[model samples]
Target: MTDNRTDPPFVADEGPMLHSWLDWQRETLAVKCARLSQDQLRLRSAEPSTMSLLGLVRHMTDVERYWFRNVLTGENTPGIYWTDRHPDGEFDLVDTASAEEAFARWQAEIANARELSSGLPLDLVGKGLRGGEEVSLRWILIHMTNEYARHNGHADLIRERIDGATGE
Candidate 1:
């Protein structure tokens, strides 16, 4: 893997610190998916489990849109790979999903989300709610960091199972 992740700074202001950690988490996922074929990317972890590197990429695409576009900006944007009828399509319907498209969308969503929240105060409350409570940019950043961290673990396991490749 062409790992380009930088260790987050140990001393920094709150905003840059959080963004660095989130970016590190994002890059970790990319590294996990690197240098794998489409079929390899789509390989599920185990029986009855829909999780895969490709699915995680697709799922994170929607997740970025959901948190940044919908919740942060109140755009009401729909899922790129899912709908009301197929909520898990991002994971479950990846038998023929395009790794190219999924990665592109995921990167685009990440870029757009970063742009949308750029220079915004961490204390700024979003236009949407979570659990009937308004969420701040700080909360979203932390949540996204945690979200990616969790799924990146799954990605690590799946990648390991794919070709015995493993690392942070």
Candidate 2:
């Protein structure tokens, strides 16, 4: 399928085919998190979940890397998150981790992610690491978008609570 996602894939607009909705979601998440201060970006919505705005950025960094860099492009890079160590590593950061570092990481990952996402057929297929599974390029794209769509909404609410800022 041809990618025509110049606009969103809604209202039956026939301009861009929107072969990958996740593309929209990725940028949407970034837009939602944009302009937030370091502290405000790192603010949490709950004691149990450290899903801060910055955390979402970090997590999305991992997501982009996981799907685009690792799964799609088959990169051997390790995840920034760990299984047992610092579960909230995505959120809780020392002052030593400057905004430039985090932003740089995300930006670098995003550039690679966009490259990976750009050069694939929508029906492309690959085997997942678990259970001899198979996944299509379409599925991967949609799943990434779904991940961002959900978390971005969370970020919206959290940011609103932080400073009454709200929008799609």
| lDDT by candidate, in order shown | 0.94, 0.67
TM-score of each: 0.98, 0.79
lDDT of 1 by residue, 41-146 (tens): 9999998999999999999999999999988888888898898999899999999999999999899999999999989999999998877889899999999999
Candidate 1 deviant stretches above 4 angstroms: none
Local lDDT at 99 for model 2: 54
Best by TM-score: 1
Residue pairs with colliding backbones in model 1 are none
Q: How well does candidate 2 match the true structure in TM-score terms? A: 0.79
lDDT of 1: 0.94
Cα error, candidate 2, residue 35 (Å): 2.1
Query: Lowest summed lDDT over 10 consecutive residues: which window, candidate 1?
Result: 128-137
